[model samples]
Target: MVAFGFTVANAVAAWFAHYDPVNIGWRLMFAFAAVPALVQLVGFLFLPETPRYLINHGREKEAQEVLHRLYDNDKEWIAYEMGEVAREMRREAILRQESGDEFVLRRVLRTAHVRKALALGCALQMFQQLAGINTILYYTSSIIRSAGVHDKITTIWISCGISTVQAVGTILPLNLIERLGRRTLVLSSLIGVVITLCMMGGAFILINYDSSKINPAQAYIGIDMNSTNTNKELLDLCFGFRNCDECVTSEYCGYCSLKEESSSLPTTFGQCLPVNSENIQHSLYGYCKDSMNNATAYSFTDTSCKTRFTALPIVIMILYISVYSLGMGPIPWVFNAEVYPIWARGTCVALSTFTNWTFNLLMSLTYLSLSQAITKHGAFFLYAGISFIGFIIFYFFVPETRGRRIEEIERLFMSEKEITPERNQRHEKTVSASVI
Candidate 1:
C-alpha cells in the first residue's frame, strides 16, 4: 500500500507540474501523501514482531511475551503453538546439519530427489520471468503511445488506473486461496490469461491492419512523400552510395546536394539508401507515409472510437487484473518453495532464486533487441505461446499444495505413498506449528 501510494503521489505530482503548472497542485498531492506514509511509519513502529519467527530463532522468552501481548486470553494455546514450531525448526535444522556435515551444497547435489526438485523449481522461475510479463506491466503506457494513442497523458493515466486495479484485485486471492485449491486457482488463472493475451494480440492486429480506421494517426517519416525523384543520388553523393567510391561526385563538392534535398521526416525505411539499384531492391519495407495526410486517418481518442466499444481496452485490462492475481501473483513462491522434500527445500529454493535473477538479467539485456527484431506484437505473441505451454505442463505435472501439509508433499516425493499412517503422522506434526 505504501509503495502504491508513493507511486500514485509521484505520478500525480509530476503530471500536475507538467500539465497544470499554474495551480501548484503537485505540491498539494505530495503533501497529502506524506500523511498516510507518516501514519504507517508510526503504526509499524508500535507493531509487535511475529512470535513464530522469534521462537524459531531461539528467542523463546521474547516469543512468549509477544504472544501474551497479542492475545491475552489465548496465551495458553499460543504457547503450545510456539512450542511445536520450535521443535519442528530444531528437528529440520539438526537433520540438515547432520546430513550435510555443515548444511553445505555438496550434500544436496548428491541426492536425486533433491536435484530433481531443484531443477524443477529453477525451471519454473526461469519460465515465469521469460514469459515477458514485466515488460508489459512496466511499459504499457509507452506501448499505448507507440500504438498511436493520441492523448498520451490520458493513455498514461489509464495505464496507471489499470495497474491500480491489478494491485487492488490481487488482494482478493489472499482471501479466496484457502477456499480454492492452489492447482485450481493457478490453472483457472492461466486459462483466463491465455484468453486475455489472445484478446490483446487481436487488438494489436486490429490496430495494425485497420490502422486507417482504428489508429489513423500515421507515424511521421522523413523523406518527401510527393517527391518525383528518389533521394538515391544525393545519398550516394553524401556518403559513397556504391561499394566503390570511384565517382567524382562522391568526393566533397563545393556544396552538398544531399542537404538541400533530404526530407526531415522519420522513415520506417531502415537505412539511408545508396545510389545503386541493389540498395533500393534490398530496402525491403512498406508503410503509408502518405497516411498522415489522409482525412480518414483516425487517432486514438476516448471520444473518437467511443461507439465502437473503444472501451474494450479497459475491459481487457480488468481481465488482465483478474488473471494475473489468480495465476502469476502466487505461483512463483508456491511452486519453488513447496514442491520439494524438506531435505531438498533449501537447495531448491536457492536454485529457484538464482533462476529468477538469471532470467531477469537476460530479459533486461535482450528486451530491446527482441522488440526490434520481431516487433512488439510478435514478441508478446511468443510469450503468450510460452505461457500456454507452461499452463499445459503445469496442469498435468504440478500437484495441488493447498490444504495439504508440507510434510505430506515431502512424503509423496520421498516415500511414494498415498496418505499412509506415517504420512498422516508427519502431516499432523507439521500442521501443529505456527511458523511463518
Candidate 2:
C-alpha cells in the first residue's frame, strides 16, 4: 500500500516533467506529496483500534468486541487472548516497579530475550541499508545514464518503470509471507540480492573494458583547442588523460567521442577537455560542444559513456527490485515490530530504527566517494559481498515467525525452561489449528 503511492508518483512526475509549463514540475511534485499525506490522515480516522491498544487504554468493551470478531466469538479463545494481554501488562508493570523506573534502553539491555531481538533487529536494519537500496532509489537516473541512456526524458521514464516494478513487486510478498514464512522470504531475498548485484557488477566491468570503448583521447585533436599559450595549463588538466575511460577520472574533464555506426561504443579517437560548468552535457568551448557550429562531430558527456551493456542495469534493476520487495523491503519493518516484548518494543524498535537511518545516511554519504575511489563496478562488487554475508547470517539467525504469538517469538530468544509446559501445550494447539 505504501509502495503504491510512489509507484504512481514516478509516472506522474514524469508526465509533469514532460508537459508542465513555467518549469514548475518539481514544485508541483512537491505539492502533490501532500495529497497522499492528507488522504492517509483522513483514512486513519476510520481505522479500527487494535485489541492491544484498546486493552491498554482501558477500553475493555472495545477490546472484547475486537477479539470477538478476530477469534470468531470463540469464548475460550477470547478468554485466553484477553488473559494473555492482561498477564503481559501485569509483567510489564511489575518489571517497571522492580527496575525503579530505569531508562527503557537500560531495561532492554538487561533483558536476555529482548537484547537478542534487539541485536537481530539492528543487524537486519543495518544490512538493509548496506545493500545500497538508497543509492539506487536516490540516484536511479544517474545510474541509468551511466548505463548509456542519453536523453534526460528517457532516463526519467526508465526510472519510473524501475520504481513501478519495486511497487508492484511488493504485492507478491503480501500473499507469500504467510505461505512461505518471513525467514524464507528474507533469506531468499538476500540470496537473489547478492546474485543480482554480482550480475550488475559484471555488466559494468564488461562495459568498462570493452575494446570498442578504448578510444584514446587526443590532447589537441579538436580544432577548438586554441594555439595560444594562455590556456596551456587548463588544456593539460583534461588532455593529460590518455583514454576515454581515464578522461573522466579527472573531475574537470568530459569525454567527447565519435561513435561508430554499428556499435554503441565510441570507436574513433575522442578528445578530453574541460566540461562546461554552465551546461555539462557539452564542452566549455570545443569541437565537442553541443552547438551545431562545432567543427567535429562529437557526442559529449561528462558523466556516462555510450556502452552496449546499457540494457543490463535495466534488466538487473528489475530483478533486484523484485527480490528486494519480497523481503528486505518490507520484512525488516514487519519483524522488528513484533520481535520484542510489549515493554521493550518501543525502545528497542527505536534503536533498530536508529540503526536503519544511521546506515541509510552512511550508505548515501559514502556511495559517491566510494564510487570515485574504487570505481563504480568495484563498489557494486563490494555491495554484493556484503549481501552474500547478509544471506548467510539471515539464514542461520532469523527465525520463522509465521502465526506465532509475541510471547512464543520471545521464547525463541530464551532458554527452553523459560517456556512453561502449560504455555507450550497451549501454544502447540494454537499453532496446529492456525498455521498462518
Candidate 3:
C-alpha cells in the first residue's frame, strides 16, 4: 500500500490547484501521507501476526490456528507447515543449548553462520539505499522540471504518470521473486540499474554538452542587466555560466533564450538572468524580466531549458522504475527475513531493518547536496559506480534463498566458501610454516 502512495502527492497538488489557491499544497501533501499511515494503523488491528512470529514466541497453538485459517483448514498442508516450523524451532533449540548463551544478540554474533547472515543482510540494506531509490522518488518533480517541463500542471500530471508506473510495477516482484530466486532477481535488477543509470547519466550529459556549444555573445547580444542595484555575484554565478544547463540548474538563475535563436536551442547559448522570486515565470533582471507592458521577445526558464532532449529523461525514469521494481526494490527485505537462523532471526532482522532506515535517512539528506556538488549526471555516475561494486559483492556473497528453509539457509552461509575461525587459524599456521 505504501508502495502505491506516491501518487498521493499529485492528488494533493491537484486539490491545491483547484479547491485552494493558498500555495500550501506541498504542506498538505505531507499531511496527506499521514492518512495512509492512519489507515494502515487501523487496518493492522484486524490483521493476524505471521505464523512464524507466533511459533517463535512459544505459541504453537496460535501458529497452527493461523496456518489453518490461511490454508482454509487444509489438514495435510497445515500438518506439513507445522512440521517444518516445529522442526526448525527444535533444531534452533538444540543449537542454542550447545551455544551456552540464551541471548539472541550474543548468540547471533558468536555463531559463524548467523554472523555471516547478519553481515550480508546489513550490506544488502546499505546497497539498497546506495542505489539512490530515494533520490529518484523524492526528487521526481525536480527531475521532470530539469527535463525541460515548465508548466506546473503538466509537470504534476507527468509525475503522476511516473508514480503510477512505479506503483503498478511493484506487483511484478511478488510473482518473480519466487521463480527467479532472491539473488537472481537482485543481480538482474542491478544489471538493469547499472545500464539505466548510465543511460540516464548520458542523457543529462547530452543536455549539458549540447547546451554548452551555444556562444553566449550571440545568445545575449541585446540583453542587458538592470541599471540599478546590479548584483555582480549573481552576474558571476548565473550570467558568467556558459551553458543553459548550468544556468537553469542553479537555484537562483533562469535561462533567457534569445528570440532569434529560440529555434535552435541546441546552440543558442542563452543568457542566465537572475530568477524573479515574485513570479518565477520570468527573470528578475534583463530584457527577460517580467513586464506588463513592452514584453521582451526572449523566452525564460528557471527549471530547465527549452530543449529537444526533454522527453528522454521521462522515458528513462519509467524504464528505471520498471526494472527496479522487479528486483532490488523489494527483494532486500525478503532476503533479510529468509537468511537468518531461527535463534537469531529476530535480532538480526531488526539490526538489518535499522540499517535500512539509517542509510535511507543518510541518502535522503545528501542526495540533493550531492547532485548540486557533482552535477546531476555526475551524481548518477557515482551511484552507478557504487551499484557496480554492489553487483560484484552480491554476486559473490548473497545466497539464493527462494525455496530454502531457514535451516537450509543457515547451512548455506556455512558452506565451503565460509572460512571458520579454526580453519583460518590452521591456514595461517600452514602459511607461517611454509615461510620457515
Which run of 10 residues does model 2 get worst, by summed lDDT? 210-219
Clashes of each: 5, 0, 0
Q: What lDDT is obtained when candidate 2 is compared to the true structure?
A: 0.78
lDDT (Cα, tens digit) per residue for candidate 3, span 98-158: 5666677977787788798889899989888888787888888888888778777678788
Q: Write the per-residue lDDT of candidate 1 for residues 270-377, one digit (tens) a residue.
A: 222222232221221112122234211211111111123345545665676567777666677677777776656666687789888888787666655675456445
- Which lDDT values do the candidates have, in the order given? 0.56, 0.78, 0.78
- Give a tens-digit lDDT track for model 2, residues 12-116: 777777655246877887788899889989999977888878999989999999888888899999988888777767666655665685888888887777788
Instruction: For candidate 3, give the lDDT of residue 13.
Output: 69
TM-score of each: 0.64, 0.79, 0.79
Clashing pairs in model 3?
none
The candidate 3 region of ten consecutive residues with least summed lDDT is 427-436
